[model samples]
Target: MRLLAWWSRRMLSAALTLLLISLLIFAASRLMPGGFAEVVLGPFASAEEKAEVSAKYGLDRGILTQYWLWLSSAVHGDFGLSMITREPVTTEFGLRLPVTAELTILGMAAAIVFGVPLGVLTAIRAGRRGGGALGRLASGFGVSVPEFVLGSLVVFLFSRYALGLTVGGYVPFGTDPAANLRAMVLPAAVLSVFVIAVTARTTRDAVLTVLVEPYIAAAVARGESPGSIVRRHVLRNASIPVITVLGTVTAYLLGGAVIVEYLFNLPGIGSYVVQAVGRRDYAVVQAGVLLAAVVFVVMTTLTDAVAGVLDPRFGRSA
Candidate 1:
């Protein structure tokens, strides 16, 4: 019963937050200089044409009325026609979302696959010898380098040296899965850097903290093997904090997707949003922003739920 109530509250809060985000997106879109019709039709388009376009899209309506109409349509998954391409916003998002999703998933997977083990090693080494220079240095490098700069360097070295890397442009998975994965590799690597650093550092710190707990010392005194202790005790306790950091890093990576996609010339939602914003394509802009917000919220909520499951104390408090 308590869990149900908590979930209901979280859902209600997420809905309210999304409502606020949608309103802000709508306002910002309307507030952009020169208006949507001017941007879509160009400066030289005659007044009659502009008026017709505005009326066709109901842009001439008052702000509140237009927002109501948009909100209603959006509730039904109809984001309306893009002023620039005359394409449905949902269709455009549908086409681009998968590319972005693939990139994000691969990047996150790489981060976890590499970061957790490195973190565990570092923590173990630190506890044993009081130093972990290599792990510290790697984390420092990951934290210091921005994704764009890292991507640029990778592209220069690989493309100039003829390293057999596809540095830019995306290949669809259906066309050739191997080529598609190869194309995404560099971008995903660049995206994973920060995630790796954050997850490693968080995991290292959490593990170090767990190592000092009396239970750990008791386990050691009990003559348990190091591997058994880590598997049964250390990792489980340490994972809560690591999961929290992963959630935060995942959110950061989604925001960074824009830069990575642009640098790699991937036709993902991030790139599509950039183009739509430049053209003041209201429908696309609103849909893209809303979609991104929804994803972020869902990811965060899931992370919390996972953490709560791992530690029931967290669930009770939540």
Candidate 2:
């Protein structure tokens, strides 16, 4: 009953948050610098044509009314027509979502596989020479370099070396699995770097905190094996914080994906929104951002749920 109640509250909170985000997305899309009518009709369009265009799209409606209409359509999974593409925004999003989803999954998997282990190593060898430097280097690099720059550097290095790898173009996995996987590799790798750095740093801090607990010292005094102690105690206790960080990072990746997709020429939502913004395709922009927000909210909620499961202390608060 307690868990059920907790989940119910969580769902309500998520719904309310999403509602607020949708409103913001609508307002921002509507307020974008250039008038959508002018963009769609071009600069040479007559004033009468622009006015007709605006009225046709209901852009002349008050913002609140426009939001209600957009929200209504969106609730039915109808995101309206793209001003530029003339196709349904939802349809375009559907086509691109899988590409971004696969990329994010691959990147996250790599981040966890590499980051956790590196963090653990750094934590265990905290005072030792060379051990601490690796964590610092990764975190510093991630913080200092913009993802676009990193992506460009990665593309240039791989392309220059001709290491039997493809650089930019994306192939549908259904059409050619091998080629698709090859195309996805560079982008996923690029996306994973910042995640990896973040995960490693977070894990190191969490593990270090766990190591100093009285129970850990007690385990050490009792002649427990180092491996056993770390596996059973250190990791178990450290995981909650790492999980929180991973969840936040996962949400961030959804947004960060745009830059990577553009750099790699992948047809993901990130790149979709970029094109929409360029064309002032309000429908596409609004829907894409709303989708990203939904994903972000979902990830954070799931994170809280998982953390509650792992640490009963969280459940009390829930």
How much does candidate 2 score in TM-score?
0.95
* Tens-place lDDT digits, model 1, residues 1-318: 999988998899889998999999999988988877788788999999999988987888899998999999999989898878898888988888778888878878977899998899998899456578799789889989998899888888988897777888689999999899889988888888878888888888999999999999999999999999999999999998898878876765564389889988998888888888888888888888887787778878888899989998888897
- Model 2 lDDT tens row, 1-318: 888898899999999999999988888887778888877788899999998988988888888898898899999989999887788887887888789888889988987899999889889988787768867787768757888999999889988897877898789899999999999998998888888888888899999999999999999999999899999999989998899889988887775498899888898988889888888888888888888888889989999989998898897796
lDDT values of the candidates? 0.86, 0.87
Off by over 4 Å in 2: none
Which lDDT value does model 1 have at 199?
Answer: 81
Question: For model 2, where is the 10-residue window of minimal lDDT?
Answer: 134-143
Off by over 4 Å in 1: 41-50, 128-130, 251-256
Q: State which candidate has the highest lDDT.
A: 2
Each candidate structure's TM-score, on Cα atoms with residue i matched to residue i, is: 0.93, 0.95
Best candidate according to TM-score: 2
